[model samples]
Target: MNKPWSESWFDAYAPERFEAFTPSHVWAVLGLIVCALLLWLTRGVIRSHKSVSEGIRWFLMAVLFLSEVTLNIWYVTQRIWDAQTSLPLELCSVTLLLSILMLFFRSRWLYPIILFAGIGGALQAVLTPNLAYAFPHYRFIHFFVAHSGIILAALYMTWIEGLKPTWKSVGGAMLFLNGLALIVWIVDTALGANYMFLAGKPSTPSILDVLGAYPAYILAEEVIALLFFSLMMLLFEVLPGGRLYARSGTYKKTY
Candidate 1:
């Protein structure tokens, strides 16, 4: 990113960089198209009345989880560190889709909080974009698409799968996200990549900033997670259909 000469966001980039459509732009577009196609196909699979085994659904989710992890590594860690920050773009879409599909087949227990985070965060992120405009590259496309996918997945899980949130579910979500945050922080230190912007060189303000300071952000997230999780449970639990059935239970969760 070029210095704005002033402090403004729009004047930061040179005209050519934004105007020029290069090979990378084309490749990124193609990648996004492929992801869209796959998501569309997965929706069809989910809608089909075929009864796939619970074990099979769990296994599919596991595969998606691992694949998304690997993609994140390649996309960020593999590249030279840049101050421009962004959410991990790799397999977020696949991860959200699989989470929904798995919740539909078997809520097990943790599905509802996942739905909450996926939906709530996506909704907020979409309405209030972090960047002023299409960034260094045209990353808005990927960011919008992937985050929106999470919302879609969460909606399907809640409305169609009837996933519900419990206290245990909320706790699990916090633990999992914080654990991942620690890992990303450590990895960013080692790899010299700002994967989670934990290195204190982020281009834009992160959720951590709004929540609080270093460790405080983690605690703040827990409190917010607890509160939001409760709201999500209330909303989904009272849906017209018995959507709560696809979840673990209709128990009300408290922090």
Candidate 2:
């Protein structure tokens, strides 16, 4: 029997569950990385052509926005909309919303937060996704596409818009994350929800599995986040090659 259109599109319990390190997962990861590399490689061309750059930015914004909206619609359609888990309180979800704003406004203030926390959070979600559905499922495609869009938003601002993030931006991002986590914690307590995995580690096998148990892993995550954000600064801002690019005056400062 053929499933109804709604069931075909929004079924929450798809037969194939996402398995990390599977061929499909690996290909998706590599594909996103290639896109990022292509953007960097063609930065000059993109900068020279304003219309093309704007179009790409708008495209990313649309993808990110639609992915998020459709995921919520799926949740509601599947009758799985719980206040605890259905809300957009997860790290990547929050970053996805911010990424949209970052692209639209080209706000320098939002750049560092997205550059550090947005990329870091989204990258973790990409590597060890906590998803229920596998390839070709709406949730699976939505999960990866939304996370990838968050990553590309940061890259677009940096490689295309030339918005530079300073070392202090690392601390800024950490502080912002901590503040957001605090708010999420309060919400989790009130709703008995585990948004951001604050109540406990995720059910899936993730980096948190090796970190430690319960509250201890939360502390460990802070250290891990710091290290990752610092590495981003080194790679994107402090590297000698990137310094040369900055000195060349190819990047027009907009904000």
Candidate 3:
């Protein structure tokens, strides 16, 4: 039986019709690749033209901000808005807001946070989306756009704006994440929500599934996050451009 499009798009807690790693997943992966390539290819142009770069950055920020607003509105209109899951407490949700701040102010302090969180969290979300809707669905489109936009913003800052992360940034990000995790843990305990997946691994099969179980997996996630942050810092160090390397002094405002 053919399912109604409205049912698929608006239904809360809809069952997964398309399995993971299927054609839909393949298309999502391809879309990410295209987004990455487009951002990389435009790096030189962004570097050469400050006005164009600012315009692009602002546009991306606006899209992310507006998409989130629209998503909340959709949830409300559908009468599915609940404190448990509707709150913007998830890592990707928080990072989307951080990405907006980073673009709006070009603050160096927020750069590492966005880069680490965006690459580690947002990239993973893209690779293994925990979504129910399929292609052409509003939720599907919003999820990919939001996740891909985050990655693009991070790469744009690093490769185009010449922002680089330092060893200190690795420590800062680890500390910040631990603090945020603690807060999320408390919220999850209170609301029985799974923000940041700290409460439990997702129902969908994910990299988290192989990490172990429950409390043990939470510890594993902490270790993984630190390692991911370190690897990201190393990437910036080894990249070709001198500007990509971490400078040894205080951060000065670039914007």
Candidate 4:
């Protein structure tokens, strides 16, 4: 007999995760590398001036974000609109949420970089074979439109709107995300679910193990995240206060 969704969800993910790299992880890492390159290319695109409609930008972004969230919620609640045996691929929700946060304020080139990351990341999930084993619904929104929707929104905002990141923004984002990671890690330790994959060696011996063991890996992640945030902040330093922010000395915005 087929497994119940609730029982399947818990069985699929409730165990402590160690060496957790799956095919999906391979795609996620590959996507990260590709998006990093795209981010660099986007840097040049963002620096050049452009003209676009803010209304369209907001409309598209709103639609993408709403659709992704709604589909995920429906899946989790098992409303049966398109139910699956399990709803274990909650990672997209977190990634898209962060991408959406980036889009919420930035109005220009910043959008596309974030969008590319969101889209690339989402697509990776769809293409990853592990997803099919994850849940039937993954074949639907999680793999395709939901992800494309996010990437397109991010790209629309970054390419057309010209979004830039500030030190303050980076600092806040890093602080919040890292703090949550810590809490989740703690909970994973207690519950043995490794909800965030922070408990031990990932499915593969990743860069984290190179850092050391548990607490050490934790520290390393903190340092790396801070460095990443700092790097993002430096981009804003080099960037001219966008024309709008220049007049106001507030990192001018387009939308």
Number of the predicted model whose TM-score against the real structure is largest? 2
Best by lDDT: 2
Name the runs in model 2 displaced over 4 angstroms: 1-9, 241-255
Candidate 2 lDDT over residue span 1-255, tens digit each: 657655765577656678999998999899899999999899899989999999999999999999888988888888999998999999889989999998999888888888899989889989999987777778878888899999999989988897777666778899999999999999999999999999898888898999999999999999999999888767855654566544543434532
Q: How do all models score by TM-score? A: 0.53, 0.92, 0.91, 0.50
Please count the clashing residue pairs in each candidate, in the order shown: 1, 0, 0, 23
Q: Write the per-residue lDDT of candidate 3 for residues 1-255, one digit (tens) a residue.
A: 646867766555555454567787789878889878987887777778989888888888998998799899889987999999999998889889989999888878888888887678988888877877777677887888898888888887877777778888888888878888899989999998999898788877688988998889888988999889988777766776433356754443232
Candidate 4 weakest ten by summed lDDT: 81-90
Residues 77-127, model 1: lDDT tens digits: 547324433344212342465465555555545465456656555555554
Least accurate 10 contiguous residues by lDDT in model 2 = 246-255
List pairs with backbone clashes in candidate 3: none
lDDT, candidate 4, equals 0.50
Cand. 1 TM to true fold:
0.53
Candidate 3 Cα lDDT to native: 0.81
Q: Candidate 4, after superposition: displacement of residue 109 in Å? A: 16
Evaluation by TM-score, superior candidate among 1 and 3? 3
